[model samples]
Target: MHDAVIGGGRSPLQPRALVARSWSRVLEAGLDPDGRHPRDPLPMDQVLARRRESPVALVIEELRAIISSVADASQFLMVVTDADGIILWREGAARVRGRADSLGFEEGAEWTEEVVGTNAIGTALAEASPVQLFSAEHFEAEQHPWYCTAAPIHDPRTGELLGIVDVSGPAMTLHPAIVALVETAVRLAESQLWRHHELRLERLRAVAAPVLASVTGPLLLVDDHGWVAHTAGIAAQARIAVPRDRRPLTVPGLGLCLPEPLGDGWLVRPAGGETRIVMTLDLTGPPAVAVSGERPWRAPLTARHAEILLLLHRAGRSGLSAAALSSRLYGDAEHVVAVRAEVSRLRRTLGGVVESQPYRISPAVEMAVLGAPAG
Candidate 1:
């Protein structure tokens, strides 16, 4: 990793206009826009201190491990920065540690675009690209001695920025491989972020079921493209009659469907009680954005509410009866009445948003209720 940082890769071909524009932006902003130090200013003590307050430190540590394995160079230092430019993680040679530390290049120091002007980490974040800064190209005199390469890290599904991965070393040793190495690290981090999102959403889906039992009908989990990810037992059985692979399951033609693509998944039901109860769900492409847990829906919850939500998730959103809900909670009709009262109070609190209609839970309520149970 160190070697790659020092003598790693060729920089991207610079477009004359772009280079001029970038330089113009720098010159127009002048040397100090924020009135802070012109040099990179993160320190090791601060970076270490930030671990408690920031999650990016852990992410950067993983990036360091990845870069070290693929690039394997000593002079090369791998660092992770937040959206604001604070260095969250840095792993490199002891010789350069002083310089890095002096710049507040450690975890807690802020390295946002505002602080460092148009440097690799800041610029890459602004442009959302892989950037290389060698020697004289650095905006600040204090940053002149190092060659730096950085790539933006984005969450795959939502394409939202997570942070950046940067490698820096002595100017003379800058190489072409640095860009590739940084890109590789960024991609790995993105993959990890996406997987984590999916698992979290799935857990929410499982938890929301019972709470929503009184809302409406079957609870269904569909992908962004309309494929089914999961379904309550009732929905599964109802859908079993319909061909699962039939493309583009249209609601009016076959059954009712939610119009919105919620991250917690769609809450839905058959428009008619006599309808086959069968619905088609698409799970064919990349996991749906709704399944990634990026957008969470709020559900009205109480202790009894939570119990009912579980039953709804396990059963269907047919709106469990007081007896059924009570059985789940206290295994007796009297207790069930008490729980039912709680549900009634919760219903009023959630308003029409809870969607109690047609003698059951509404599809929208089911979508939110069956997806994320109250903590």
Candidate 2:
């Protein structure tokens, strides 16, 4: 029920009296005649669950270099606390560290805003701001002797609150450089964490390249910022070159530009800040689209499906008979029958739009847009 008096001691103020006054204010302002505070409290089960799952040590080694550097240069002690306020790591003077731990302020102790009321470490996290608790400003009577400074550590990329970095020792001995020092150190730790995750994702993608190519079809892996990351080898067959020009490349036939380079031969489409992979066959071999009365519809062209279409476009006529077209296409009678069956399936799929007429392909319904636009 204590009012929290927060901030660095800027004026000529007695720290203990400020704490007492703040406490009295909070109790008087918050409590009704029934002595109840009008606020919904969080469930302890959910709080414990979130705290247990927090991974503070995941980047402890990376952060250690900065924490040690800060602690070694400053007279104040440095400690890393998990999201739950449990001190996970420390680097500072041995004397301060010992005294802090002896006062039940060591690793595994929950010093969260909820548990300790209002203190430098807990309050910094609650308010998502840097805090400086001078002597006697701490919520608890026992903690009144020490002053503490803390800042919330966040994942640089995601901006998620990771933990807290704090420096604590005796109060009344204020140093000018403590706040800036802790803030800069926390920022460095966050930068390291982001770099670590980025490297990890890059390595994982490299290892999964082969399998990713096979299952996801031809694709291009792009970064979050719309730059092409990976291009598949098969993409070479397409007119568009993979890793093209160190930027997003245009698809040869499709009217789309990929965000990231398709190193794995995949192109991702961006819509509303979301990326999606689109699968398309390489059409660089030849134009497969044909026009009406262009070429006689061939029964089957095994090797020349693409080339034959081009030839048919140039010559305005129907195609050869099944056996004849087969020989013309691949020079085989059995293959001609197979091609005919495939063409039949194509007709079925095309429905009434495309018609199979002897050795000719005709559009049952004239399409206003057919073949290349008349030059």
List RMSD in Å for every model shown. Answer: 17.7, 21.8
For residue 58, what is the lDDT in candidate 2?
A: 57
Compare the candidates by lDDT and give the number of the best one: 1
Write down the lDDT of every candidate, Cα atoms only.
0.54, 0.53
Candidate 1 lDDT, tens digit per residue, 246-338? 111223223533233345545444434332212211123321211112223333244545445445544555666667666767867677547
Which sections of candidate 1 miss by over 4 Å?
A: 1-17, 32-61, 69-73, 202-216, 220-375
Please, what is the TM-score per model?
A: 0.51, 0.47
Predicted model with the maximum TM-score? 1
lDDT measured at residue 7 in model 1 versus the true structure, 0 to 100:
31
lDDT string for model 2 (291-349, tens) is 22311121222333433333333333464557755665676776865766655544332
Off by over 4 Å in 2: 1-55, 70-75, 213-375
